[model samples]
Target: MSKLSLAETAELSMLLEVSANIKPGNIDRFHDYEDTKFRHFLASAVLARDVFERVPQMTLGEAMYAAVEHTNGHTGGNTHFGAFILLLPLIKGKGIAGACEAVLRTTVEDAVRFYQAFGKTQVRVNREDEMDVNDPASITMLREKQMTMLDVMRYSSETDMVAREWTNGFALTRKAADILKEKDGADQIQEMFLRLMAAYPDTFIAKKFGYARAVSVMERAQLVRAGGLSLSRFDEECILGGVNPGSLADICIAGIFTALLEGWQWDC
Candidate 1:
């Protein structure tokens, strides 16, 4: 068994993902947004420890809501909202694929609670017409339609990377965990982040900007991987453009948690 408890692993994953340098546009040890500082993320991660510890005992929706509630108490803005969404199910299911799938088979109550959680964050999300999470009426619609959390995820999957993870059995998160297994040291996390950014147009960027800009970010990442673009320059452009790839960062946290749970050591 891993030495770290599930909560500890989850906390470490959040810490590691945020502290990893050169993450481009996202706050890290070396970068910070005006409103959301690196220390805010640290505070949010620390505050989330108890919530993660309680995840196994809580329903998925309750866990998510609790996490956002706890984290929001410390941070001025959203910090780990997306991370909680991805990590709670994994923690509840103990990182087993089948168990995780079972955790995702949510209830109508789960959808309601998840929307309640969504209201806590300033995290930008793609809006759905029928069941927009930002709309107060959506909660009633969720009940009338009897949509489960998974159903909401399915509806948003095409435009939301986090939702895609829910609908697609967390394929990217699991794959990232597998990739981390092959890497050796703290820098490996940065490498994994870059690779993920290169492959996928970050949905957070897409939501904030446009699909074309999101694709441009991916292409720039590919250039960075191919040694054609300087990492620093890319980071500068993204920060200047307010093109934060937050969805990928959230997955990176979940991936790191899965890796740590499976005995991947943090050499740093």
Candidate 2:
């Protein structure tokens, strides 16, 4: 394998997270989500290579939304929405803080393109009283509000953990990276995943099954991880229960990418 740069490492880390069974509550080599299967994720990863490679030359929002569109065009499902959001600024030769700053600095054009990209990726986002991407007037309102991509994220940061990452400078992922750097090898992925899940209930689960169920999963993670308990049944139950801890998984991937970029060898 060739020596991967930070952007390349971050892109591959998403694929590695998707391929790892030990991450728990994720579709990996051992299990599959009913809607999104193994092939879909593999396809998503393959599609991401060009997007990741081209990101440096693109603006933050441009690269972010375009990658989402590109990935979903191939997979027909939300594949790397969170990864795309997180990796955009990182791949632009910015540190995590720089990435957050870039989000705040995005212009109305950036917001517009990202809004359009929503139609393509179709990532499951909260639309309670908010306008849908399909609503023709949404773009008009987007222009009216003169919102930046960061403004859009701020609108949803209250409930969406992924959005919070963008608005708050990816605090969780950064913290998890610190933990990952303290540890070593592939085991750190599982450890970081659990730590993240336990600390914060998975946003995907909360969106699907309400916040209480999400909290239960977090509690379960606490117990399962504390004693070094068997994760086999937990993994089985999470999948069977339709509990894909996607946000946590996404954050964990960020942590892994951080570790790899910082010269920690991933035990593949």
Candidate with the greatest lDDT versus the true structure:
1
The residue ranges of model 2 lying beyond 4 angstroms of the native Cα positions read none
lDDT of 1 by residue, 82-200 (tens): 88888888888888585367556789999899999988788786555567678899999999999998888888899889878887878899878888888767788988999999999
lDDT of 1: 0.87
Writing each residue's lDDT as its tens digit, candidate 2 over 203-256 gives 889888889999999998888978755788788788778788888777777767
**All candidates' lDDT scores?**
0.87, 0.77
RMSD of each: 1.7, 1.9
Best by TM-score: 1
Candidate 1 weakest ten by summed lDDT: 96-105
